[model samples]
Target: MLSLRVPLAVALLALGRARVVAQTTVKTVDLGYATYQTDASIVDGVTSFLGIRFAAPPTGDQRFRAPQPPATIYGIQNATVQPDECMQSAVGNATTPFRLSKRTAFVQNEDCLFINVHVPADLDLTSNASLPVIAWIHGGGYAGGSNGQNPAQTLVSNSNNTVISVQMQYRLGPFGFLAGETVAKDGVLNAGLLDQQFALQWVQDHISKFGGDPSQVTIYGESAGAGSVLQHIVAHGGNTQPPLFRAAMMDSPFLPFQYEYNDPMNEVIFANLSQMVGCPISNASLDCLRSVNASELNQMGQVIALDNLFGVFTFVPVVDGDLIVERPTVTLRKNQTNSDVTLIMTNSHEGDVFVDAAALVATNSTLAEYVANLFPRMNDSSIQQAVALYSNLTDVSAPTVPEQAAFVMGDSIFVCPAFYTLDAFPADSNWKGEFAIPPGTHGSELAYLFADAVPGLTFNNSAFISSFQSGFFSTAIALNPNTHGADDLKPDWPTFKQTGKTMLFNETTTGEPEVMTIPTSDALLERCAFWLSLSDVNAQ
Candidate 1:
């Protein structure tokens, strides 16, 4: 007899069992996931639970296959503590100055297919009601990141309606990606995307028990996360929002696979990087590589080619026509999506963080050296223009040469991606385009959205709080996007028509949402437009 056992206190509160006791603060709970269940402690500030398994391990025979659903359990699983972070390459080591934030950047492992959930402290798991939920996907070029990286306690606490913040982990690198032939038979080769879809399904089936309004969910992310969120909409025939999420926020979204797929430039990157980490695929010795330890594979993240040769990134989610229906750009241009859900398109400075001199100094010492660091076969004259444009964007009072490089990084990567995504929107879309200003870098808006990181980073609370609330309101709009959150601050922002509507987020001055083809700060899109028209020009 498999008699399931639940905690005495929790059992009393279960549907079948009943007990009454003092209402004490609970910092943790058990979420008995299939396979093996464990206790994950909650956080002090809010109702938080760590190490909630979202999917079964994608290891052993399960490698590269679409993730299997977590098994069901009759007993309660203790979710009182968070598991370690997911397996990933260490970007900046603990000693690195940029890695000094209080956040824990370590504690990773291969069996990291779990997610963390944080909600308001007063959340009543015993209630028969449901609250709106938000799922967060972290961005790391799809190479490094975990559910533990971002906490949703603040967002959930701030939300007027009940909200749940979830951060889930997916496989990375050769194990998660490594697209070729065998994998495509399953579908459009992007297995990582499938991992995400599965997690959303888990949310739909199980979130109600956790006090989440399954029908009012919102999928949100930044950078690669933004790309994942967008992929859900235009891919497969199903919508992640209709049944899964009613709203979505795509920030600094990028489509790396659309830009390049198995090109010589990136092959060199892979080959060279593999060599640096002692895994070069010489003499068809990939068999040994396949059996290599997962930890070793992650350590190789250090060798990833930094060469921006063809102005492309490697190992991103692809539009395999299976997982992702079509390229995000094409879908937006065609407006072949559910316009019922409101979409928020956001971007930031192209250069600030990437151009950080510390990274340059860490990687190389001189400008000429950095240029040479770029892949050797580089013939794109755009490289010269890219460098010049970066320098021109900065002021003579710039702190250092590297400080100016941030602008170049911003323009080439983030700014362009944001511009391309918004511009691709047809007059047929319910999409509204907005860009963060001034010192906006990749994760800067996080400072505003998260209160703890705000004052420390010199972020304006007043402007940010309103903006954050506006985001919540806009998420509501995703269900019916045209609905305004605060008419005083944002009076029904208009969707674009080859022209973007700008809504500046400033703390000191009163600003209003306005319409335009582009912000005054935006560089015209004439050239990038014509070039992008030839997106499929060369297959490499």
Candidate 2:
């Protein structure tokens, strides 16, 4: 991590936390274990309960391992006081407004596996109708982030039908993605995914208490969360073995989970453990690490010299073979999906916010410095090509560079991965692809979907935008997986073809879909296609 001492940044004292689902009126339910009451009057007429912990704290010996299932209390406990978030540093510098609650999410703790549920107040959870369930996993590159995201009161209120929207928090950073002989030999690659799987299992067992139909579950998420969704779908074969969710929607998902970013050069992931207890790599001792104090782990994470390396959560998801099987595309293509998992994969205009030149754009490179940057990453040639292409794209002043390169950055990392994922699926297979050009970046859809998109449009044209989203998604999900209904989410829209007919999600063109003509729209991208090809070829 950092030089063993954590630096304390200017910690802003903030309060006025957004109320979870505006105060509302709805009958509460007692699971005998806990009493979860509903707060209606949320912005979108939905009722929600905040801070529901799904599992016991993974402290002490349970450190750096799969989450243990939560125990049910003997009596009704007040389901309030949202669980403190998992250990994750906040991205205050992010162009998007994802908050700086705890620059490193001080809310984090060993006891961090929890789920927050929101539902339309209009429909009671105890009601008999089969309302759809949307289980969302938060995104922080498998490193940091919480279940209490932009919030889903709006979606629950506006959908006009009952929906159980649950957002969850999981272990992050070294705690979540730490991979080595100790972790691998113990049979866990992405222990974070293990937390997600258990959350789904929690839903199947307890959602009904909140009036959620486990059979009508739809797992959806953006960025890393979306990647986790796809991973779950392909990991255990559509959850059919036990059957957690029936459908899935992945938005700008991390389609392929890679490993180069975690080991050796970034050896800091487990440095604290080594300094305090765990034997070094030569020893492969996890038991030593397991006995270390949890607070010490938290302190170690905060001090980690990530900016020195590259941003927060350095120990991101890796191809460790246990939690993750293979690159997302490879796994799906090889082991056909047996369950009807409705697919809605998407991307945005600017997904890779940090792709800016000031960050890692290579220029006037020393060969050693260059090699050090992309060390051990398969082909050495592709590193230079990536640097050259990145340098060129960053040079927006050049007329030769198309304006669309802004979106292309996201495409290569986020959107392009989804494209590769869809292409891997059999043609004529159920799938939908769309892109949102709203004035925003990564997780920009959060405000539109959960919080407010355009502040001025509140109470006026809000219905139109809300209806558009509901119409589009309802239609796509129903038809894509043939999910027991013939209803369309919106008007005439074209299903994505091998040629990549992308649906445009904008102010004027909500449902009307169109094609992104790469031949003309992306002619300049050729400058980097060669590099990309080499990168892939070199990987193979």
Candidate 3:
């Protein structure tokens, strides 16, 4: 999930009002309950219907429960503005990464279950031919993110009217992922994930109305959102067929062991939050939590900040043994993943977003404290072993203690687990991973893909990457199904099974992307072996 606000330098560029003219054509789409007025992206040849509700508000008695679809609409509903973001703590400049001159308007509310749709105007609107769809799930550690942050308008426009895109909003923070014995007995863990599944069901049922192919939907997300895609693949023991999505792309999936509600560590998080909000520690605690003010609950959630070593999110999706029936790796190894084709991508400096010089200095001075933070369950001997294995003096690639720690954290939580996830697929399945070289921070690629989001911003691949990304999306989703293998000009992206080969997205001095292939490294293999040995390390 993106925590970086559009910098103040580009605030003026983002403030331009959309010019609506009387002569412009007005398009309307009717779902069973509501009719929507589609807004045209004048410069991009795209029409969009924003703020379409996919599920009923998780409000009132419905709070903390699985989402239900909104009831029928009484009349034509205007869908100009998308819904407010799901509830989250304010991201004050003090906590934000960038130093901005202006504060972003941080608006959030409970009635936030909605979806935004964008369609290419050049598609054959008169015929019944439905266009392929890309359903984008935003990531903010599953604790704080909104679909409103990166609108699909730029992505659709960049695809040259050949693709249709959808962005959705769901419950966030404690409201979405609080788990414990009381909470689990009465309600579900990972309601936010269930919310996403329901949204996909909505797309399957209603996307055809807006010229989108229900059978051709591709689910894609970044960060925690990418984990959501992976979860869906292994959902329900991975036996279910005719998946909601035909394919998937995971951008930096963060896979930690999903905990059972009864685990001591998991219970403590819930129990502490319940007590902080004045809830009784009995079976009634879940009910007591329901009665608390939504704002108060959101505020209390801030007490749980990013853990030092593992970057554990306090309230996150857990292993409930139902929706997420087994460990992701377990189900994945059993060949339970749903998508026919999968793509996983990550950058070289993912740790740059979360780890810094301050963290490094702190680790260097207090190595034991750092070890305890990352491995609370370990014994003195085990902690010492861990510190030794992760120590910079022992590892030359990252010669400093801080850099070594960052490398271990990133590889353990993200990079290696991604490798494990790919290798877990059936030997015959189609899957690939890409490593974006330096300058490609966490979600920095978005600036190139959706330059419209932050006006005046640019990247080396800004001129051609959009087309390349769109072509890749087309090949994956079958938007131009016939042209995939036949397109000679496109890069021959090899499958991982063949040679353990990975496509390197390198940023060169010249303003262009240089794609190369390199055999998967032995160092990554060795690092992943170490991390996988501690797969159940109780990260959060």
- Between candidates 2 and 3, name the one with more favorable lDDT: 3
Best by lDDT, which number? 3
Q: How far in Å is the alpha carbon of 355 misplaced in model 1?
A: 2.5
- Candidates in order, TM-scores: namely 0.74, 0.77, 0.87
Which candidate would rank higher by TM-score, 1 or 3? Answer: 3
Enumerate clash totals for all models, in the order shown. 35, 16, 3
Q: Per-model C-alpha lDDT, please?
A: 0.53, 0.54, 0.67
Weakest 10 consecutive residues, lDDT, candidate 2?
1-10
Give the runs in model 3 whose Cα sits over 4 Å from its true position.
Answer: 1-24, 40-43, 89-104, 123-126, 306-310, 366-371, 378-397, 426-429, 433-437, 451-458, 462-471, 479-490, 509-512
**lDDT tens digits by residue: candidate 1, 10-99:** 322211122232223553343444422222222333555555677777665565577887666555455434455555532223213433
